[model samples]
Target: MSPGPRLPRRTLLKASAALALPWLLGRCGLPENEEGLRLDPDGILDLPEGFRYRILERRGDRMSDGFRVPGQPDGMGCFAGPPGSNTLVLMRNHELEPGQDSLSPYTQDQGRPAQAYRPADNSPGGVSRVVVDATSFERVSSNLVLVGSSRNCAGGASPWGWLTCEESVTEGHGYVFLCDPLADSLQDAVRIPALGKMNHEAAVVDPTSFIAYLTEDRSDGCFYRFVPESPGERLGLESRGRLQALRIEAEPRRDMNAGVEPGATFRADWVDLPRPGAEDDSLRAQGAARGAALFRRGEGLFFHEGSVYFCATTGGPESGGQIWRYTPEGLQGGMLQLLAQSRDRGVLDMPDNLCVAPWGDVVMAEDGADPRWPDEHLRILTPSGQVKNLARNAMGGGELAGVCLSPDGRALFVNMQGDGMTLVITGPFQQYTGTGL
Candidate 1:
């Protein structure tokens, strides 16, 4: 069966309708269309100077192992090995199934459905590598990395190295796996069960402390963080760790208990009530729950300037899809800031995942929207709560998922989820931001 229809590459920007949502639209002012740049009905996805995109190794791009890379591609990450050794390790979530839809040996089984993420089974949906040149934006490597991971969505890198690909399926076996693209074969894939058993979207690690802040893609899913009892020496497997929830301002809720590392926990470890719906079994219940026991479908996460920031596809009780911030000085003290409320930001248009830029701006990808909207876009928000239209989706009709600006703050890499391709953006980063604020 075909996947969800591709959202139009360009759609009209949803001018904020409410007086209360400037924090969502962000600091940048919306620029009226001019200069004749291409945009779709969704009003999203714009490419910058000295840059253009093409279909790289597409879905059927034959791998060394011989199975065609099928299924809808989702979350991805890129690493620059040495200079210009652009090897991109992408966790392409297949959203696959059994029967003819299954890959290889699973097809021979006849009736039994395959596990979503057992790589040893060599399933079709999971993580893969795409080596490219940073300078030229050309794909160099031609191998698919990990295979059986179910619904491998957006994942981030640990400061040391390696990528954590998240399995976004609640049932039928879901997990989070580590991938090292530079290596010849995949090894040491960490399956941290304490992180919860919901449909996970992505995770961010604090290299300074080695805590994993993760989000679930389900509507009522809960947000989580795994605190390494023995901190991993930066971007690696720690000697020990425990998964905890994000305790909000209303943390001391009457319902749940406290975390094991509450006093010692450096990151937020108390989970609040998600929504009334979050009580579903998807949550990997462990430490006593607190605050909002549910979540609004957490997506992506990043740690910057001593603060851990993440996104929820669906917002909270009052909001729908919000970008939240949490700062903790260990279990001693912390605060969860609502930050920018999206219902007021460009009609929300349905945000998926997000990344941070050099100017300390949070860039978000708007993927899901109603049929009425004609364009989709990658948005940016400053810490001060300002939003701007960074790029318009012009990959014909692709959902821009993962986004990142190079370390030197040069080129920006964006993944087109609908088409399974990565594009690079360069030029003025600040001049592009604006705010209704």
Candidate 2:
């Protein structure tokens, strides 16, 4: 079947009246007949008239460490390079499996690292580091940082390091691993079992509480939070913690896939899991037995302004998508709100990864619900519940993933997973980002 129609390029200006969301239009200060996406001459990506993208890294490209760039670039995080430096560090993940040896970064002669997790097997998924000059927007160096993990899909950045989560449970590889961006060579493979062993999609740490929030990528997944024994530890992932699942205060075992209003709010509580580090794939079931709330494939988590924003790839009545917000009130309780959900696939289809804009808007990476029509896009969801396209994948090679903005918000980095391409788009970002919200 054919997919949904594409949203009009001129829709952003009229959103205030059409959706009655004046808060977004008033704060954005966008002018009429501007900020519309124009087709790229190369037919790879379409962006606004003033915006342009630069191909930073791609599959098969050789790195400084003498290994070719791996395929299936998924989730990524951008960090400041170093003190008194004008460069930025990017940790990119490759979602490869054991049999995909052709896409491995290591050659046959080199083999895998001695400290790799399950070194006997041939798991090629890991994280790679790329350094770029912030001023010039040029790549400085690229190399492998972590190795031997399976399906390092989507992860989040923390002050300690990048929390790269494995999206697989086979061979005991469904745990989160922290990778230091400053490490030039491959680091030892260490898993944080305290974070729970399940099909992890992404993770983020609350700066104030030092508690980590994680998402599971299964249809029956449950949202989780980890409270470390030592909250002040620099590298808190290794510390032992109590893992708990979210539960609705009013209703127990609430299914969040459908029948949720756009602005619905709920008092949220947590239930502790006796065994977070389980050998089998039973963490979700364990949470369910204890009255934990359920989600439809939870993915892509970001902590912004004291709230955690996450997405459910296949939620809503039409299975389009859903974006949720969780604000931790204290160590014991929080408020959960259904910020926005897609009723039409054309407007917001399968939002996989997302990041908040510098000016307080939510930016999303669209993984289209249907593969037949490959018009995936990088979309923006306003606080007032309006959606608009920021960029379109004209190439139709893959779904957009790893949507992140630099610390300075001058550059936006995204990846095309199936095509194995990473790009940085730069333009007049300040036009929409007014003086803070």
Best by TM-score: 2
Q: How close is candidate 2 to the true structure, as a TM-score?
A: 0.91
Error of 2 at 381 (Å): 1.2
lDDT of 2 by residue, 1-437 (tens): 12224443322221221121223322222222214777687878888767889999989898998877899899999988887888999999999889998888876678677767787767889999999998977899999988889999999977688999999999768989989988877788657888888999999898888899999999999999989888867653467878999999888899998577665778999999978878798988989999999999999999888889899999888788888888888899888877677665655678999998766667889887575445888877665544556788878636899999998888999998888889999987656433243
Model 2 Cα displacement at 122 (Å)? Answer: 0.5
lDDT of 2 at 198: 91
Deviating ranges (above 4 Å) for candidate 1: 1-28, 31-51, 63-70, 82-122, 163-172, 186-189, 233-239, 249-289, 316-320, 331-333, 344-347, 383-386, 395-398, 434-437
Q: Positional deviation of 236 in candidate 2, in angstroms?
A: 6.6
Model 2 lowest lDDT segment of ten: 12-21
lDDT of 1 by residue, 1-437 (tens): 11123333322222222122223332333333322234333433455443344444556566544445554666666565654544443333343433325332222323323323454444455565655565565656555455555656777767655445545443444566666656544333555554445567787777777777777676555667766666764333333455556554444322211221111122244643233123244354432344434556677777776677677665633333666667766753465555554433334556777776656667888775545544567776654454455666655545777676666556666767666555566666765553212
lDDT, candidate 2, at 156: 94
